[model samples]
Target: MSNIAYLGIFGPGPNSSAAIVSDNEIIAWAEEERFNRIKTSPNAYPAQSIAFCVKEARKLGLEVTSIGYAWDCNSYSELATANLEQTIAKYPSETDHISRLAQQGLNALYNPTKVKQDLGLILRKLGIELTDQNFKFYSHHLSHVASAIYTSGFDEAVVIVNDGVGEVASSSLVYVDKQGTMKELATEELPNTLGGFYATITEFLGFKAYVDEGKTMGLAAYGAPDADIMAVFDEMVQTDGKSFHYTVDPRFRYSGKRTFGSRFTDLMVEKLGPSRPADVSAMIAPYPAIAYAAQKKLEEVLFAQMKYAASLNLSKNICFAGGVHMNCKANGLLAESDLYENYFFQPAASDNGVCLGAAFLAKIDETGEIPKLPSLEHLYYGPSFTDDEIENVLKQCKLEYVKSDNIGRDVAQHIAKNDIVGWFQGRMEVGARALGGRSILANPLNPDARDHVNRHVKNREAWRPFCPSLKKESFQGYFDTVIDKSPFMIVATRIHKEFLDVLPSCIHVDGTVRPQTVNKDINPLYWSVMNEFEKITGQSIIVNTSFNVQGEPIVMRPEEAIRCFYGSGIDVLAIGSFLVKKGRR
Candidate 1:
């Protein structure tokens, strides 16, 4: 039967979710907050996300059959040690909220019946039938493990997943075997979490906890790593190689509430005095220093865990999908190290990607083989519009525009001539990084391209480094020791000094670049464009940055691209089947 059997819904949190394994592919997949956009904890149900999935399934000409959540918070993992029913009864107030919010928020895990009700409402919204037999729950970390190890194109890989607390599981290690099957080596429940520690440090620095860690990562590149604070982190984080534990520097802990604790804040003050501090009057330079210190320490502990995991699993290759793996710089360090011969971090490393991971996991469970690797050619996963749709927006806006010349070729020539051109193609990508599909391309030789990009297009923090999409053949010659193959712009590796002038913009202050190695096999059009530019200019890579300016999402529509073209300092814009250039640039 082509009818979709198993379905799963995640609410985009470090909470318990549900998953079902049916005969065919993942029947329906979605997150709760993609519908509400407010997000839910694991205990919450994906009512809205489910509705959208049902709608999408209708588009696929199928009716959903079995519905499963990604969580067996019903069983036990981090959320409950053993008797989940008893645990909920132990916390009645939280349990009451669970009842009311089960359909929406993830409090369902705390209260089992609420979880059942949450699933009930999901089925109700779809106007579909359900059964106690149809309702199967999953363990949160098990879902995480299944999502990564099952899908990665590895016969055997050591898997690591970590995110905000779920089932009390802050970390886990999975060993996917040669048969495309895996077994859980061990799972680390919280009170010893790198993610938990990162979250606390994130909020301590005046940002939202789980959400602001990227901000802190960007902030870290600007600061100095103080030895004292380095000492603090060293003493606090203990690692056994396979997993880690974080003991907050008891002398200066703040429940990790504020961006800067009295002790940490004070340490910042003592180490690096106020740099232009009349505004806030605290030691600001040291904040990034502390952040750098924290990030550096976290990487050390994490790599230690990775190394231990490699040893335990005895897999030369390691595949990672977790919140901790989101730290690309740390990934870079791992790439440089000899711990794993091959390492792959899932592009959608965050929780949002888990939906795909869950579906992939279910596929793995059935096939017992690494589902054929979907070419990482591009990340064109979001919505796309047709010419009429684009033209309608264009006509409605009354914009001056005509579809221009051979877009890919002309833009390639322009890039060869050292011009910055915004190339918006196919669809916007699904993750944090922008691949070639939606990017700005330029000749990498221009030493001034970095500042030019910052001043004109990005207007982001000057210190935030630029990324390069390098030709696969020339990759090793231009960059020193680029062992990791990250077409996703996730790992930052160094630019060899001998070739610094060849691709100046791609080089960071620390002389590293988050390189996206392009090959005809991986991303053909993008590769061709870069290849054509390289042939003309004698340089094999292009300075590629996201196609959006500061304080804005990447321009989605053609008119938006035209608007950005005129408003920003971009010399050219590549719309589909056309080239639009600003006059007198």
Candidate 2:
């Protein structure tokens, strides 16, 4: 009955993060990459992140009593060893089993003993005891599921967690009852993972795998999936009612040689032609078409898998988690499907969110009760800077700045004048997308906004589309879609042709857009800025992109934001209540 403070830790891999839960409420959460300024540190521990959570909790008069590690590698080891042994017996010539065994020996997925020691060291540094009674571990997929279902506020829902690889299973389907009891029905093990398949294709297309999948999704709208490519993907995966299996011609499957140099790339090339060079500047023939084909195939397989799960679970509400759920295009299909009445994709759908899931799972195990938290109303749970912090950073850099009473309206007015502004306010967001707390803002109506951002600020592909953050009430006026409340920018909805020219900066080449619906209650300053922009231009949308350069992680601290403002092509910066402009002293 007493408030229990639980700390959740995820990763020593990509998208590592930490979260703190006080009984039924999440007090603070943050990804490690945000604090470290690294783009998903695959091998870094969440020491700084965990320390931040503890410090943040103390500020709120709470003490973390237990730590929940987000993965039980020992359980995964048992399952994987058995499964691989079975596969080796069944397929004598296949090398996937051997390669996977090698990776397992390296403890790529996890190592219980090693991780416990590391956690002990980190927790002790934070003045927490390192006892077995104070630490717990949850299975990877279960943690992913809990993150979605517990925060979803759905009494019962069909839970699906799909990612590159969790221990051994890449995807899992489960049914959660109104009492928060979960029954996992099926799992798709490694080598057969859709997450891996998509990552392979993303790499083949010259973008970073696991990181630039959004690029591939955006490019999908530009071309149609070739029937031949679809045939190849169809041959790679097959599904039954309750589960799915992979038949990727071993020659085309992952062999653990190079990240992108797999039999999979060769097979894709055989089917779709040579892969695109990563440095290519133009959206030429075959690449965009390949992206389209790959995305379409992914949607087809994922949708079929979802259909099978829905047939078995019979839940009107669905809670989605994992890396694959980050695919907004695929999410759009699921959202529009007639099988489910409502679907919720956690804002932090990637591995970065597993920390939250792990904490919730630990809470449930310790107390035998599901957290009584409401639906995830907002993701602004990370650290927020004080006005003094922002002013100190500005003064340290000797930058001329103006403090305004109405920062939102002042920033919005500058954006209306065609200047790209770095908007940093309140707590930092926990997900990959820059919702509002930390974002680069521009007038979506400006004809040159997209190109300027891509070429100068982002230094990424021009073909990639920017997202629009519009007031929730103005969503339907621009986009044509049935899935209404898209607060996370997870569903790529069709942009009304009439508004395409008006907000061309945010529209993709395929006429669809990923949009974040801003609600006043969740983010008042962001909503106010959007409203101010609307008052000036009669358009309710603004171009919203992560406030960082191409390869860097989103800005977290005030110093990082200030450094980024000076380093990039951003013309103005709205940090807390102060306004900073380029080339001014």
Candidate maximizing lDDT: 2
Tens digits of per-residue lDDT for model 2 on 1-585? 354588899978779999999877888999888877789977788888899999988877787777788777667667777766665555444456556667677464467888888888888887888677878888888889889988988888898888888877888888889888889887877657778878877877777888888888877777776677667666665554333443433335554233345535355566666677756732777777777777877777678777887777468898889999999888888888888888899878898999998888777777778887888878888889899988988888888999989988998898899999999999999999999999999989998999999988888877778999999999988888887788898887888889878888998887778899999988898999999988999988999999999999999988889888888889999999999888744
**lDDT for predicted candidate 2 compared with the true structure:** 0.82
Judged by whole-model lDDT over C-alpha atoms, candidate 1 comes out at: 0.62
Compose the digit string of candidate 1's lDDT tens values, residues 1-585. Answer: 354544565653542233333443433443343233342343345565566556656666766555445545564432443323433354333233333343234443445566677667668767876667555555656666666654465667788887755566777777877765567776666445777677756655555565547766766776686887777667656665444333334222322222334223333333333322324412365577767877887787778767777666478878777777778788788878777777777765666566555555544444443545533444554445566676676667665566755566677898776678988776556555678767888777888878888887776555566788877887787777748455788777777787776667777656677888886775676787877776687777888887777645556557667777777888877766656666672
Our model 2 lands, by Cα RMSD against the true structure, at: 2.4
TM-score of each predicted structure versus truth: 0.79, 0.95
* Residue 407 error, candidate 1, Å: 1.3
lDDT per model, in order?
A: 0.62, 0.82
Candidate 1 has its poorest 10 consecutive residues by lDDT at 250-259
